[model samples]
Target: MITMSLYSEKDLDIELLEEKIIEPVNKTNESKHIVFIHGFASNSSCWELFVEKNKNHYIHLINLPGHGSKEYKPYHLIFKFIIDLIKKYIISIYQNYGPIILVGHSYGGAISATVTHELKEINENIIEKTILLAPYSKYSILKVIDKIKLFQIKNSDDFMELQKMIFVNAEKTVYELEKYLYKKLSLEFFKKNSKNLKWVILGMSLPSTFYKIDKAFKTIGSSFYFLFGEKDKLIDNQKTIQRSTINNIQPYFSIYEDKGHAFFAEDKDRFFNEIENIINL
Candidate 1:
C-alpha cells in the first residue's frame, strides 16, 4: 500500500499520477472513503466544492494522466492505458483503506463505471457504490459536426463558448475560469488530449466502437446512481435513460431540470445532497 501524503498538485510523479487524500478531521470507522475521478481534460481540482462539503468522509481525489499538473506521455493518451492506471489506483486504495465508493463526472463517470464493473470480477464488494455524474457513454452520431467543433477552440472566446455549453448559469464564474482555461488550452498537453478526444469521438461513429461502448454500459453488474443534467449540451440525457432502461442494469437515473454538464459546480449544495442521499441508501 502506498503511504498517504500531503503532496501538492505539481509534486506528482508519473508512476502514481496525482492523488490527494483528505482524511476527515473527525474520522470514524463508519466514515466512508469516496474516490473522486474528474472528467476529460479536467483534473481533481474540479471537486473543490465537493471536498469542502463532504468533510465527514475521507475523500480521494485523482487526476487522470495528462490532466492537472501531471506530466503527459504518449501512452497516457490511450484509453486502455488510462483505465489500467486507475484500476491500479483503486486496487492500491482498497488494499490500504478497505472498500470505497466512487464518484466520477463526465469522462471520469464512464471510467468509474468500467472500473467498478471490471473490479467486481475480483471482489464484488470492492467498490461499495458508484455515483456517475453524466457518464459520457455514447455520443450521438447526428451531432458529429458539433462534436468536431469542440476541438476547434482557437482562443478564449472559443473556450468561453465551450463553457457556455457546460453550464447553464454561473456566467461570472465561467468568465473567471476562462483565463486559466485559456492558458491550459494553449498548452501542448491540452492539444494532445483534445486530439485524442477527437479521434475517440470520430472512432465512436463506427458501428463496432459504438457497440462496445453500449455493451460496457449494459454489462454493469452492480446498481449505481446515474445523475444527468437535463440541459447538458455534452451528453444526451434521454438517450442515456433509454439505454439504462433497456439494459435493465438497475442503475438509478436522476435528472436535474435546468442543470448542464457541470451542474455540480453550478449548485454544490444540491450535488452534495444527492451524493449524501445515495451514500445513505
Candidate 2:
C-alpha cells in the first residue's frame, strides 16, 4: 500500500513520480489491496475521507503523473502518457501485491475502469472489484460551463487567476486540505506545462470514453459499482441522458436523486457509507 500527501509543499519535483506517488498504508494484513485514484486537477488528498473510513484495509492512493507536484514537462498530448504510467504502476503493484480492489472519482473513475478493463482482459482474477463514482465515459464534458468558467490560459498569471477562481468557487464544498492541494495542481501545470487547458482536458477525456468497456462490465463484481447523481451537470449532457440506462447492468450502478457531480465532497457521510458497504461486502 502507498500514500502520497497532497498537502505537502515539499519539493516533489526532485523525485520521478514513478518513485513517489504510490504510498502503502495497511488496512489489515488479510484485506485485499484497495487502490484509490483521484479526479482531474486533483490529487491523493481527495481520498482523505475514504482513507480514514477504511483504515482497516490495505490502501493505495495514486496521485497521477503531473499532479501533486511541480515537475510536469510540456507535452502536446498527455492522455496516453498518464494511462501508460498508471498501467505500469498497476502492473507493478499486482506483481508485488496480489488481487486488488479499485475506487476512483470522476476522471479517476474512467482511468480506473480502463485500467481494470485491460488487466482483466489479460487475467480476469487480478481485479477483485471497481467502484466508479461519477465516471464520464462515452460522452464529452467540455460543455459544463455555466456555473464554471471555461477558457484557455495565456500565461502563468492567467493560470494563477484560474486556480484562484477554482479555490474560491469550491470554498464551501471542498475540504481545507484539498483546497490547497487543488491550487498546487493548477500552479504546477501552469509553471511547468503549457497553457492549453482544453488540449489537456481533451487528452484526458477522449480515451477514457473511447476505450472498449465490455470486459470492464464483465470483470467488476456486483459488490463494486458506479455511483452517479441525477443532478450532476457534468454528466447530464443530452447524449448522456438519452443512453444513460444501465438496466442490463443495474447491479453495477447506484443513481442518487438530488446530488451533483461533487457528491463525495458534498456529503461525506453518504459517500463513505457507499464505500463502506462495498468494502464491507
Candidate 3:
C-alpha cells in the first residue's frame, strides 16, 4: 500500500494537500531514492504503475502546485511558486536521506529540468541523475501560436470545440481532462489569479526556458535521458529534441513508435524495462 504524508510551505496554510511515498516491499540499505513529479492536472496516481514495478527503489511522488490535493493559491509568479515548492520538499528529503534521482513526465519534466538547473548552480551533487519523459521544449513558431491562442477569446461553442480537439480518443483521456479542468479551474481562487495562470502558460510556451536548460545541461555533469512517444499530439518530439541541440544537451532519448502521448500507459512493460535500464545505469 502507498503511504501518505503532508508537507507545507509558508505561503500556503492548508494542510489537506498530501504527497504519497510508495516504498518497495523488500527494502534494501543500498537502494536509490527516486523522486517522480506528475505533469499539469495530474497527481501522484499517475506513477502508481511505475511504483509497483520498481518497488525496490524508494519512490517519492508529489502533486505539483495548484494541482492534486494542494491548496490553490493564485500568484502572478507561477514558476517562482513551483520552484519554492521544489526547494522546500527537496530540502526536506535531503535532510532525511541524501540526494535523489528525478524522473518527471511532461510538465513535470520541465520542473525537473528547471530544478536541476537551479540546484547545479549551488550544489552540483544535488540531483544524482534525471530523466525527462515527453518534456516540453520551446519552439519559436509554437510559442507564437500559443500566445495568439491564449489571448484570442472565442464564443462558448468555439471554446468547447477547442477543448475537444485537445483530447485523445482514449476514454481515460477524457476522464483525466475533466478531472484536471475541474481541479485547476473550478476553484474560485483560480479565477482571481487568472493573470498568474496566464503567465504560467506563456512561460511554458516560451523557448527561452529551454535555451536556458541547454546552457545548464552543459555545465551540470549529471546524466540525462529523455523519452517520448512518436504519436504525441501535444508536442512535436523531434522539434523539441532538435531545440535541445542548441545547448548541446545530448540525452539518451527513445521514442515509443506505436504509442501516443500516454505511451507509458499503452505499454507499461516496455516502459518499465526502459526505465529499469536507465535507472540501473
Candidate 2 residue pairs in clash (backbone atoms < 3 Å): 1-23, 1-24, 2-23, 2-24, 3-23, 27-56, 27-57, 27-58
Candidate 2's displacement at residue 113, Å, is 1.0
| RMSD (CA, angstroms), candidate 2 | 8.2
Query: Candidate 3 lDDT (Cα, whole model)?
Result: 0.63
Per-residue lDDT over 122-175 for candidate 2, one digit per residue giving the tens place of the 0 to 100 score: 887776888888765556445344423433445555654444433323545443
Please give each candidate's TM-score: 0.81, 0.70, 0.72
Give the candidate order by descending TM-score. Answer: 1, 3, 2
- Kindly give the stretch of ten consecutive residues in candidate 3 with the minimal lDDT sum: 158-167
Q: Look at candidate 1 and give me any clashing residue pairs.
A: none
Question: Which candidate wins on TM-score?
Answer: 1
| CA lDDT of each prediction against the hidden true structure | 0.72, 0.59, 0.63
lDDT of 3 by residue, 119-234 (tens): 76777677878888886545323633543353232344433333333334455553454543532343433344344445556555545555654554444343778888777766
Candidate 3 — which pairs collide? 24-55
Off by over 4 Å in 2: 1-29, 73-77, 145-171, 174-199, 205-224, 237-247
